[model samples]
Target: MKDINEPSTAPLVIADEPVNSEVIKTTTATAKNSSNKKSAGVSSQMQLLALAKNFVLDGGLVSSDKQMPLEERTQKRARIAALRKQENLEAIIKKSVNYCSATEFTNKADADWFSTFTELAEDVSNTTMQNLWAKILAGEISQPGSFSTKTLKVFRAMSITEAKLLAKACSLAVTEQTKRNIRIISGAYQTPGLLNFFSKNREQNITFSQFSLSYADLLILADNHLVFIQETESNPMNKSESFHFNFNGKPLTLTANKSSCVLKFYKFTPIGSELARLISDNIDDTYLQHLKSALSENFSIIEG
Candidate 1:
């Protein structure tokens, strides 16, 4: 059916396809896709330009001599730098052994003892942990048999500062416990030097201040099961005096402050005595003689 020349209405052909709702939807989706591509391309170009600008401002994408020193800038090598893996860590630990024992170092014993606590090494990899570990180990080695499994457990339970305090206190029990024929004062064996050093005007007495422990320090030791402070029935009227004992061949004196406070005595537990053994064994003969004479002068046992 051909309309040759008379103004033929052959259904104005907009396109070859049907102009349905589906066609409209497809056209809209294609337009949206094209718009999204343009937006993405613009965003990508902006990011690239920003990166390039930043690079130019920051030493032109290269660290020149003025930007950084050669010491700070190590060149890359064909082989990568060693990574810090378990193997590397173990290697470092083993290598650290060489720096342990030297004559100049006071903690040589401690440095070597770290091997026993190798499991704790991870906690001490940094300087802070290393320092804490060194202090603890130093205390352990202060007395050969002082550090035990129990001590290790206790140390882990506390901070490094408290552990250091505990160790320092432990080292101060410098007298050995030995049976001696001495006078009993107030129903107890009293050392003469103990009384003499505590007498009035004690500053005139011989100086012995090497291992002076404060009330607080004693309390700390007591808490640790080393030594206990036994208050002898707090008597407000009773004033504890001071005395001196020969330590390190020096007449070291301890003067109890004259206070109407309750009298406290240091009673060494069995474990405390064990700790003392490693610190001092041989008592000075001269000091022993002095203690005996003082006790005799102070008390006389009356035969019933």
Candidate 2:
């Protein structure tokens, strides 16, 4: 017999049965999850309310015009448009900060350039375009005059499709090792000589269409001022002449096998070259092989 006041040496029971430990654990977990969700909802609502308050403080637009006059409604519409533009500018500024290099800016951007940039950038609503704008801003800040105002004017007029076309062109563009001029080499020709007076000059060219860039595409690029209006030929190279070029960021050397080896190519304009700096090197293996195969016939091709 135990004293009535003494504690009993027995497990606590619910309804005269053992409680399920697993069930209790699961119930507690569910309760915690519900609490967390409620807290998260409150936080989100608070943030949204803060934003709404700020917007209202900044002259919020009327949600509806049940009894508003036409003039008043038009004014409200313009205000909203301006506010949206301000928001876009703010977003671009934030994005530009992320791209700032650790190195101090070498020079300050021109005031006129910045003024023009803001005017055009405010109208850019697409995220991709916004990012591009941000990069331009960052680049200008790092090195003033890196991009010309003319380039900005041209780029501002470009559509997304045109931008993509430019990017594709950049991927195919090549530069000489010692020069920054970018060009798209499509063909090579041996100048007509006395031996071929009655026959056409020997030429080897690759169809750009097979590489996903058609002649029509080139025309579009030219119309946009991204490339020259016509295909240009380089001065003929003498026999055994060696040239160094950077193809898709790789070094390539070509030694001419015969005299008067002229290259047919499309040259990028100054504005185009400036914008091309923003593009990364993306090598097209098939196009590279095709170019090499064609050049091999007239010269010795070496790639590194």
Candidate RMSDs in Å, in order, are: 27.7, 17.9
Tens-place lDDT digits, model 1, residues 1-304 = 1111222233433567645545534444444444324333333323333333322332222334344444333331111122222433455445544434444434335544455555444433333335444434444555444455554444445444444444444433223223111111111222225655575432221111223445676677667665656632223322334333333324433333343322223555555444333332333444334433433332221211
> Per-model C-alpha lDDT, please?
0.38, 0.75
- Residue 63 of model 2 has an lDDT of 28
Q: Which tens-of-lDDT digit does each residue in 89-206 have in candidate 2?
A: 9999999999898867577569999998999889886777788889899889888998888899999998777787888888787898755789988888788888744554378886
Best by TM-score: 2
Tell me each candidate's TM-score: 0.30, 0.75
TM-score of 2: 0.75
Q: Give me the displacement of residue 237 in model 2, in angstroms.
A: 1.1
Per model, how many backbone clashes are there? 7, 0
Model 2: per-residue Cα lDDT at residue 271: 84
Model 1: weakest 10-residue lDDT segment is 179-188
